[model samples]
Target: MSTLDTSALVIGVDFGTDSCRSLIVDTITGEQVASAVEFYPRWKAGMYCDPDRNVFRQHPQDYIDAFTLAVRNALAGVSDEVRANVRAMSIDTTGSTSVAVDRAGTPLALTEPFRDNPNAMFVLWKDHTAVREADEINTLARNWGGVDFTRYVGGVYSAEWFWANMLHVLRVDPAVRASVYSWVEHCDWMPALLTGTTAPDVMKRSRCAAGHKAMWHESFDGLPGEAFLVRLDPLLAGMRERLYRDTYTADTAAGTLTPQWADTLGLTTDVVVGVGAFDAHMGAVGAGIRPYSLVKVMGTSTCDILMAPAAEVDGRIVKGICGQVEGSVISGMTGMEAGQSAFGDVYAWFRQLLAWPLALLGDTPDAQSQRDGILHRILPELERQAALESPVDTGMVAIDWLNGRRTPFADQTLRGALFGLTLGSDAPKIYRALIEATAFGARAIVERFREEGIRIDEVIAVGGVAKKSPLNMQIVANVFGLDIRVAKSDQAVALGAAMFAAVAAGLHDSVESAQRHMGSGFETTYTPDPEATAIYDRLYRQYREYGALIERLSAAEAHPAPHSTELCTPN
Candidate 1:
């Protein structure tokens, strides 16, 4: 590693599903000097969402407000000199969280008439309300006698992506369709917003978000052509023109911060804003990702990122995973993505299920306190008990498709299932099964990569679940029959953004150099237990069998065989 610049500082802001986190880091040592988090006020209040319908929307103002507060608060903990030395900033966000915008790139939700309209707000990445639209896209891409836009994206278009969500909104809302000028991903928009270059054509789009979600590949000559989009839906007729033709890697600087934003954030106008990308991509970099090393961002949902030299991937496509985009992670490497749609979220769902009685306990202060206490303890206690359960003896098996499958094929229509449950089944037993199921889901992704000739030499884990949950980590390691290393930084996602900022600010020659100087080493490693791995190998076979059966059943239910009255009598 080269000598680092101790005087330089960079800020990395991470926008998650519920909150934004800001971290100030020293460019020389990668020490997290100060950090703060602020929840989106409107999202925290559960506004513009319908859980049952799988429709989730976030107002743009919430992002702006939360980011502002988080940065200001994080900066408050540091000295005047440290704050003044801030050279550049970068951001990562959950995607394909996107919103409709006017020509100037202002989100529709910020306008007067669309202030409260969910359709005008950002459609969150987990929102699956656009299933029909996604299906339409898949069907069109496969049969439309044009370029298969989804070929690089696992040959499936997902509801939890950009075009499907945009199409869904355009088809349902006439006012929005007529007035909207373009759409913007949350990751791309923030840097543009800070730089005051919000115009759809002028803003630098993220290669990661565009390639993974919107099917924007260099071979396509930009986004899917107007004819293909129009054939999918008339509402998308002119959208191709409205969007941009080029996308940028995160190492590039979008622009310097505008005076207005600089004043708002208590920073200088010279501060550079690096182009943003999806959280998991940057998080992988932050965790010290290397070629063929899978970095799993284990969070509410998971986004597993892998990188390889261009020569290794070279025109070969891996089916049933997320998109394989060149330079999405490192400038010259192939960044491949795959993930489980629900990881930690599955645990949270069970916790909520177990705490149902708390709803009836009333909203008084004491009752609320009791409810909070119990809720907080539920997961830890479950983890403890689940750890004690015999992994081989637990007959229960679960499908971690509660939020649908995101990898080994992206199918948002699939629902979760539990098998082998009996009268003797208890909460801890069930919880153990759920944890095993998630691990199995992860293993399936790893298997797919290997099956497709992509080598995974090691696994590095980052994010909340990786840092907090040893039980889950051990299960995952056992299921994979491989050792798993957890990254030391708690805010690896933000750290990644800062690394990119360092490059964009000219503090480092390349991402690799910045990482060499700034990267935090692994905190611990989880080695697979031989006995547990042997047992899981058997259970994994059973899990696959059950999953295949469930998928067949689901397909039959969706498209049943027609009845033949005459045939029944003959039989």
Candidate 2:
């Protein structure tokens, strides 16, 4: 019913940690035609999370509601003919975040009494409530004679990942656990739901999600053996059987859009739906990731993506990273992921901490307006003031672990610390230290890859921090001692998904071809300052020593003995 032409469009849906965005892009020139974003209402209201406990969840209805709104709004002004010619749709979502589903493929939170329960909802990517479960996995995997499941995932299992979250939920909520038929990642579910393949046992799983977060690797043949899972927990005995063994790449089509969804979004049912992936992985493709090129998606959190030729990597397992998977970013290359648990989040936390005094004087309307104005100007003003002081002027250093360490080893038990605070240290002085801390966290990830023989020739940055925060960008450039190129597209993650959609719809032969024509390219480069780089190099050593000291103290506190050598002895 629709004609294929240069004017055809493909849509990319990016379901982020806080919002869902729908982007319509022209197939010919990769120009963005229209886009709309809608934040999760309940999530924005903070209805389902206890930040103090590190518990974060989002109701399934919020995702459904936001997606429908975003798509409809994005397509509002387009002509009917233009809508009919849309070739395909693709999706990307925050990783490791999953929801428990019923036999009918309905998320538990969408049905019955569970509708009001937070545990029945989607666990967010940053949720670290399963720290104990993750520790158990690491210990058991190390002792088990089977293939090391943690090897591909940086020799460490994380509370922020799949199995730990599943195991923890099963232990905590017996009602939901009994009702849940299986689990599905947010990335995989969006595409499956669009194509009407929401079957618990048969929905398409993503190689990106499975390989990076669920310990799925070619070496294990599929997921870890049932015997190994049973050893971990009897409840997990049959989960592996329920989950699909075959995972597809983003270039593959999930299926055609269902008529029900098609009508709602004013699209033709013929539009194909491509397989889904994590946001950062798709973002790397959007940023034009080539072999040895590192792409960092910097936002509330940071997800660092790098790809290399499979032959060049030599199958070496990089320690202390998120994971390394073949075809995760590009079809023929090995994609490696690493990240900081908090980046912009550190600045946000500081703002909240500073708001206490303002909160006490907020009853009057004038006071409220003043509070609002302060929030608006805080970050930019901090950057302005902070520029006046040198890194050594403050003699202060901070750790960006308020949300825990996500890479170079995943440890949720760690908390942030700041040293050298003095009466002379003002708000801007402390803010500078926080920014520097996040930069250091990123540097650790890059260094880890190189230490493991993975080359990084160029660095590309995409996302809010990269685009809007000049201070952060320059600091990152200096910290890594490398030139940082910021992507031109503000919506690179969504654009990357659109590229996959183009391939799935046959507009392009592969993702690479689509990228060649559709990529937004780099807009600006921030080269490291020789003077600043040298100063950061010295501060980095101190940061490492401080991190080690904190770990020692935490270990001693956790296991107090008359004399403990755990900190002193090497693992």
Candidate 3:
């Protein structure tokens, strides 16, 4: 493989929830030269999601299609020299999203008989259908006499994670279970797919995904013991060896781009593919992470990443957060992750909720067009009107758990709650309350870290929600009672992936050096307003109480008791 020297170019592919984006950057200057994005056609058509059941899947074909389209389009306008100068590429994807694969590493959905089966597709990160299975795993882990499997990850694991999804599928689909050889995380599989190393034994796994979601760690001597998997499900018997044991950080090369992929993308075969990582972790890198600097990737969901010196972390497990792993974000640093399951998703839900009525009541073609128009304007209008109101203006309060809680606990069974609604409440009033609820959820994560002895000295916001929503930016700042700096790059996640690509290709000796050269400076800073801060503090307390009540109600329904008062016990 050819190593990139000075003036070399690299590509960073960011696979998001809805689309894939390719970014070409100058290795030396970190300047983005060209970029392109293409939505997942099948996903856009709602082919793999059953929203009613909280089942979300993405076909690997959607990813393959987007891969070719995004990269080809991105390089379309660039000069031949620029395309040829591309020394390496790296990718970041949503996680703990994972997919079932055959012995050859092909996703089952890509083959016949399983071609249209959602169970055979890539399970998206937000899929919560495995809640019961996750609960079982947690119960077992807590009671096990052996080392806690959740030591590296937060104390609690979630249905949104890897093993839960895999076990859930195995139990539900005998055909899939019989055909599948092993499972691979999206972040790990994508790069391996590009490098033609999808074989279960040869495919490289990601430290970020494996450490955070699959409970793979050095202390455990790799994955959870084979006995643990068998205990969880007899169907998992002998599957541990099919999956990988070793994991690499994003700075390492998975392999050179395969000849087929190189030819398809009009790049040379020598282009290296860096080991992959989840989008938020790389986004944190793109946002320029420092010790105690919290990077919030505020997209459909929010992944809050923080890294600190390894000595400071002292191998202390920060309970109730996501995984805290070494080299997951930056090599030689301790990476900590926390996130809400839904952020922008909450807004999208509200939009869908309102649009249902417009679509049902107004059936004409003009009416359908009008409904689309209304949906487009609703959020922006709400933001404008809500910005004028104070926290007290609306007697409404919302809990940002529509997609369930991801941090402080990984309970998918809990649902969202909205209380204190009155006839006086209008669209904007309720909307503002929802926005505040999200900010409050974010604040809870920050506080959880502090409570666990992890300091967050600064907050950096990135992704679509951070750049587009002034109200959200200000509210989060006020809620945290700290200034929030928005990263300058709108494509920080992709840019961060590119930074990794540069390092893997030897253009930079390390990720820190690449970050120093390519780091996009801050674009805007949101300073907390004193008046807003006081009001939010009061409401935040109420939000927690309200959320607690909902949790109690959910638990009571799940396990009925004559006079149940044990629910929502103090943590």
lDDT of each structure? Answer: 0.93, 0.90, 0.91
| Model 2 lDDT per residue over 129-247, tens place | 99999999999999988778999999999999999999999999999888988999998888889999999666889999999999998879889889989999998978888887889
lDDT for residue 160 in candidate 3, whole number 0-100:
94
What is the C-alpha local distance difference test score of candidate 2? 0.90
| TM-scores for every predicted model | 0.98, 0.97, 0.97
Better candidate by TM-score, 1 or 2: 1
lDDT of 1: 0.93
Off by over 4 Å in 2: 1-4, 363-367, 562-571
Better-scoring candidate (lDDT), 1 or 2: 1
Stretches of model 3 off by over 4 angstroms after superposition: 1-6, 360-367, 562-571
Per-residue lDDT of candidate 1, residues 1-571 (tens digit): 4435779999999999889999999998888899999999999999999999998999999999999999999999988999999999999999999999998999999999999999999999999999999999999999999899998898888889999999999989999998899999999899999999999989999999999999988889978988998889887887888898999999999999999998998999999999999999999999999999999999999999999998879879999988999989999999999998899999999999999999899999999999999999999999999899987667888999999899989888888989998998999999999999999999999999999999999999999999999999999999999999999999999999999999998999899998988899899999999999999999999889888877876777676667832222111
Give me the displacement of residue 136 in model 3, in angstroms: 0.6
Q: In terms of lDDT, which candidate is strongest? A: 1
* Residue 269, model 2: Cα distance from true site in angstroms: 0.5
Model number with the top TM-score: 1
Candidate 1 TM-score over all chains jointly: 0.98
